[model samples]
Target chain A: MFFFKLPFLNLLRHYGRTSLSLVSIILGVLVIILGRGTITGLRESVIRGEIDGMTGHVSVLPADYPTSGLLHPLDGLYSLPPAAEQWLHANAVAWTRRLFFAPRLVSGIDAIRVRAIAFDPATDADVFPRRDWRVEGRIPETAGDGVLLSRGIARTLSVQPGDMVVLETRTVAGAMNALQMPVAGIVSTGNPAIDSIILFLPLSAGEDLLRTDGAISHVSLLLGRRTDADAAAQQLQELLGEAVQTTTWEKEAAPGLEAQDLRQRFLDILVVALLVMAAAGIANTVLMAAYERIREVGTLRAMGLTRRGVAGLFMAEGFVMGLIGSLIGAMLGAWLTFKYSIEGIDMTALVEEMGSGEMFQDIPFSSMLYFGFSGRTILLAIAVGMIVATISSLYPAMIAARKEPADAVRS
Target chain B: MKICEVESVCKIYGRGAAEVRALDDVSLVFEPGEFTVISGPSGSGKTTLLNMVGCLDTPTSGRVVLEGKDVSTLGERALAHVRAKRIGFIFQSFNLVPVLSALENVETALHLARFSGNRRKTAAEMLDAVGLRDQMRRRPTQLSGGQQQRIAVARALVKHPGLVIADEPTANLDSKTGTQILDVMRQMNESFGVTFLFSTHDPRVMERARRIVSLHDGRIAEDRTREKPSAAGEVALTSDASNESNA
Candidate 1:
């Protein structure tokens, strides 16, 4: 058939209009790709920071601990049996026990509210390595009257390493207890919330200050891979039964993570909406072109071209438009991503307002982003373009086909 | 054999009070190898009658028989099939697709006729026959009026259609160019045994036709045959022969 040459030459002949439409489609596609990609990147950074800094892939807590809503005073730590600890040691790649509570720290006239975590420095190293976490000084070598204060809290108290700090908290019997300890370190994590409020102490010192005897809050476990976390959680649930609650990192940090997931979903919806709008614009452009060529269509029809052939010509034009637009958009999007990925988008001012030290501080942008480019997206776009073009051509093609050859001759 | 037969054909437009009868009880027969012209002013229904015979339009009543089949009763697909296989059309404006070269436009018709293999070669052959082989690669816009008309002729004849319908084929050209186109049609009619039906108002085209049918007010005003030239190449008038017989 002479179909191949006609549509291609037609597009070339009307290069101005075709190029205009191609620009619109490319811009639309670029917006979708960049918008979705940036949002996903942000969410992933947050999730990785939270999971790696605090909770491991999975954590086990007391069975009586409330799973939903805010934690109450009655929600005490879980006490794992010897068998349970042994089971975790055998099954998990890395695991640690932690005692977590909110307490008061006092230095002279300064008093600050803080979250204190008691962890065995040796076992916890595999999960939350203290060496990289410490901004100054170091983790206490042994269980002694020593504490590590986040930089923000340390600044507020005008205290440093070797300075005496007082810690106070309520016992299970509802009585307040206090202990004087030497400041062991002042840490600065880039996260403002964590840097300003967290106070870490040796397990034995936390035991003494809180008046708790050898009791722990939770056992957090890290698997070799994130994929193993879910299955291990399920296995822990079955083995521990009703005596303990086992949760994956997703469940433990559901609130913060859910918000991130919602943002991702919104980006997806926006991308799809933009694509649909672009498709409509493409349909309109092709339809108008078809209308302008009514006489040409009539000529082809009178020459014995079938209705299908006439429609196919227009559809092929649209498919070519889609292919060209998508290629240009992908390249443009990748160039922009590369340009910005290196310098990064600064949100420091915005981050300060949100009570974080740096909102997106030098996001170690991955050298390559995974673009889910399969035959499916390209094929679908082509199919949609063709269908839209064919449908839009129907009225004009039919009008041409039904025209009297005599009328065409008269004109 | 009758190449086209229209029996009791009626074509009406609109409804009731506003209805216009384009063709009323129009019956005509076209014989093979004849150059027949249907000439009339605008709105005399000449074009409508031609469309019905060409299978481009259907009559509201009666039947149009083309090559032994009743075309008026055929569905759109079947009508298209018949048009593709048996009929070719030349339009006055030379409605060649502007995107394609002159050769490509002619080859398109051959493609539709299902002529397989070496379409371009066949198209060039048709163009060569029309004395347009040199201009085959030029687009329609690049060609002169007479050249475009020649390309249109090549397109119509590429499919070897048994019948050729030219609807005012010379309306857009000058008198000289129109005469050249008429000469081509006359030569094709004489050499190929293809039936020719022209709906035209050009006196030159009418004079060249072997049989002239004049239409007025939706009816035939006159149907006459001119006398054939003698072997010595002298023109003879049939009216003169009739008057001599009366004397």
Candidate 2:
């Protein structure tokens, strides 16, 4: 009881300094919780958006397709095994076939390379939701020269529906051919990889361009839970044999994962900077308190508190303050997480404020980014608070403990 | 039996050409239950001598025997332990912990000694003994100088220390309050048989001491003992002999 009493009473004596220290700690922890929580939520949400909207929960391609070349050949396509198709039908909630090709869209002096997906809209709609895809015009009709431009491509090419673009590529006959297509719509897939240089065309159009007879590049499967993606991929690979590679969305969305990792590193630095600044404030408070209470320290030493005991007293005070600050910060952080999770932080406004960049893609629901305060967020905040508070007080406590009794008591 | 003994103690400040001896072979012994005052002018080494005997400092060349154990060569931790367990100190500034109340201030010393009894009760009793029963909850800032000094006395005596050192304790208090504080210490000395050593320049304070040792140039010039002061310790103000002694 006295162990707590000594520090508690001492804290009451200098309430101002104690409060200042607590505020610094609380603010630091609050920032950490919010910052890390937002990032965690955002990264997870984007991954979810990618899986549900474009990449599906899993994708199956030729085993060597990943390393075959930057622009995987249209002719390298493998037909989906009947067993794999049966399993996907049994386990997957939705599925779609896509014909992928790397083609150049040419218009007068402008020509840009793009990864195009030829999809059957009726089935593709079931695999991917338009909620976040956000079409600016209309889906392509099955006939005529029709293509859907990604928002980025539409912006770069400055084209709207009814504008003509020339699609040029090497056909399976080893001859380069070109065809004119009228832009049908502009789409925002939310996944930066898909939006940067992606377009949607009728699978028949791609087949006509590539002369691949009727072969599709890969099949996308959506599952009830994303966590089941890896295990399902493994099951599909075994069922279909090793000739094809079945992969999760994380592998399929490599650039997004890398961007998330980079953002995570940035958040780590931000959290440390916040903690260091707070620690500096705590250290300063303890030092000033030590200087102010030199005589009291002498009295304590003369009274029987060992050098260790004197130091322990300060640490106890800091511990109490840190525990309070972290608890408050955790609650505030949790509230922020829940609040953002519901109402969401508007990414569209944030992107506009930040301006257009390669890092910030034009995903439709980029407008409302939600958040969650996971257990990891609160635990990290608490750890930073406790460690900073305790360590920051140690130097001043030791210095105070070293004060000479005679010098302090003299006058 | 002697409660404390300072044997031929010497203390010097600075080094080489800048050095000046603060104490030159000063020797003093405090008999058990004696109220001894070591009086001197400023810089006469009385405070230095008190510090050594209180075990707050160590002399350059001498032995300090506290409670029959020589603490002259003891390390800092050991000296601190002795200071905590056996010696109590009342400073000129009263030196009560400002954060602690009168009772807690007194309780602090007993706590340092690791006293086995009920700490709060013993502390309250000591405060009451010093006429602060009603003011036990007041902190030093809340109490007047006299009240704070009495609290300091309670802090010093509550641990039942063998030797209690007061260095010019009454210097900051007026004569009336000073006498009141002296009376409390004397009563504790009479009742509990606790030895006390004081370093002061006040003749009025010196007059109340049963033993008066005067110092000159860091050396003892005269040592005298009278019967313990009268019931009215304030009468020391009327004594001309104490005034002329320094002159």
Candidate 3:
């Protein structure tokens, strides 16, 4: 119908003005797409890093273990009973025991305080696969007395593999002790949190150094599939009894995810702000078009177009503009998401450049950040763009509709 | 039957100190097939009276009856219906929608009038009548002022309205182009028998009128009938009523 086609022609005739409105809508859609991508990507990356580097699919810790801060209390360390250990080995797909402690490493006169992870070298690799590890020397193996120093701590202490470093810490009995150990390898795992302030030691060495006999801080388990974690943890909890508490990776990662939620809230605010700005731009465009075409309104009315028809004309123009701009922006945003989700954004380089990788050690963080997006996100962007534009044009459309047919006589 | 009747119509603009009585108790009648010109100097109520008959505005007091119905009391919606189906307009500026081609401009009028018969064919034939058939696809901006005005004339006549109101339709054209426009309008009027009411100060337009209604100081000063333009280039006055009168 001519009524439907008229609005498009009207926009085409005034393309310069239409293009300005389109640009604003495009920017607003882009913000939405990128904002969602960033939030989803960050959340996924945190979960991935935690599952691979710290918690396996599930973890069994002492019932009263401290869940916050860098300094974990060593007194809570408990040795797995023979029955519990045998049941875990039989039931779990893969299992490993680990000890976490804070120690000060001294190389020559330089020293830095850091978190150290002691692992069962033989079974640790099965549960926690370390992919993309860059090391100068080889990692410590089963029963190996040598420690693997992270690249950042090694640099700070001015030490390399084959050098002896003294680790000073307190025993469970509250006695200060120091142990001299050989640095077997200096590694950069591409995880800023681990690389910057962590060191790896064999569990045997950790038991001997801390004089805790064979006790460990926790036992991490890997299930057949990620979805099996909750059931496996519940089963493990019944077997392990009340002395130990079984928790899934999701539960362990909750605190870090809260920070991500805060970021999501900020992104939500930003999305609103951007959309409002785009809507304002659309409103201004419609208003200016109405003002510029006053005589055209008069002529249209004189031609017997109802007031509603004139209003529909302007609203249709806005809707078309929003539809176009949002589609383009969504596609561009989606392309960027696909590219980064597969290739990943290199947070290692970013952290290294800023020299702030150590600050990330307190939370589950990864060096490669991947973005997230979906078809629903694109659809939502388009709908939002159209709705905002239509609403914004409402007032201007009314202003145009109010023109007097007698205005046709005016020059 | 009378095409339009204005019964003591009075139009006031603004309010209080700035109020203006643009048309003061002016009565006029237009017969079917009559090419009538309402001639006046500036501020002489020629346009105001045209507005009332065109259904573009309502009189402050009194009635404007178009095709047997009093339109002055009609609501906006009813007035729009009257304008669309019964009346056509041609402005001094030849106000064709610039975005549409000449053919499309004429087609729009048919569309507005809700013409049921072959709109495109009707529009094209109307353009052919105005001698702009070859340039029907060209936009208004692409055409000369005379051609644009011709297209406007085509648009006005294509809908077969009972009355066509043209306000200074030839004011924007040159003398030669103006005469061509006048010739096209006169030919259309004679062929279709669509009553035309014009408000203009152009002498060339006044010379071709079948009837001339002169306005002075917001009231009709003279209503006269004259013979169609003669081969001798002289207008022969058939009848003259030099006061508020009817044609």
Tens digits of per-residue lDDT for model 3, B12-96: 9999999999998988878899998898889998878888998889999999998899999999889988888988889888888
Give me the runs in candidate 2 sitting further than 4 Å from their true place. Answer: A1-23, A62-74, A89-96, A100-215, A222-245, A314-327, A351-367, B231-247
lDDT of 2 by residue, B1-247 (tens): 6788778889999999999898888777778988888887888888788878877789999888987899989887788788888888888888777777888888888778889999999999989989999999987899899999999899999989898888888989998999889888888989999988888877766667777787877888777776546644543322335322432
True contacts kept of 3: 0.63
Highest lDDT model number: 3
True contacts kept of 2: 0.57
- Residue-level lDDT tens digits of model 1 in B89-200: 8888888888789998898888788887688898999899888978999999999999999999988887888899998899999988888888888888777889999988
Please give the CA lDDT of all the candidate structures: 0.71, 0.78, 0.85
Name the docking class for model 3.
Answer: medium
Model 1: CA > 4 A from native: A1-5, A11-13, A38-46, A63-75, A105-109, A120-125, A128-196, A199-214, A224-231, A238-243, A260-276, A306-319, A330-350, A357-411, B227-247
Each prediction's DockQ against the real complex = 0.46, 0.45, 0.59
> How good is model 2 by TM-score?
0.80
Worst 10-residue lDDT window, candidate 1 chain B? B238-247
Query: Interface root-mean-square deviation for each candidate?
Result: 2.1, 1.7, 1.2
Given candidate 1, what's the lDDT at residue B31?
Answer: 82
Q: What CAPRI class is candidate 2? A: acceptable
Write one digit per residue (lDDT tens) for candidate 2, span A55-142: 7888887677753223757656767768777888899999988888888998668888877888877688888766666787788858
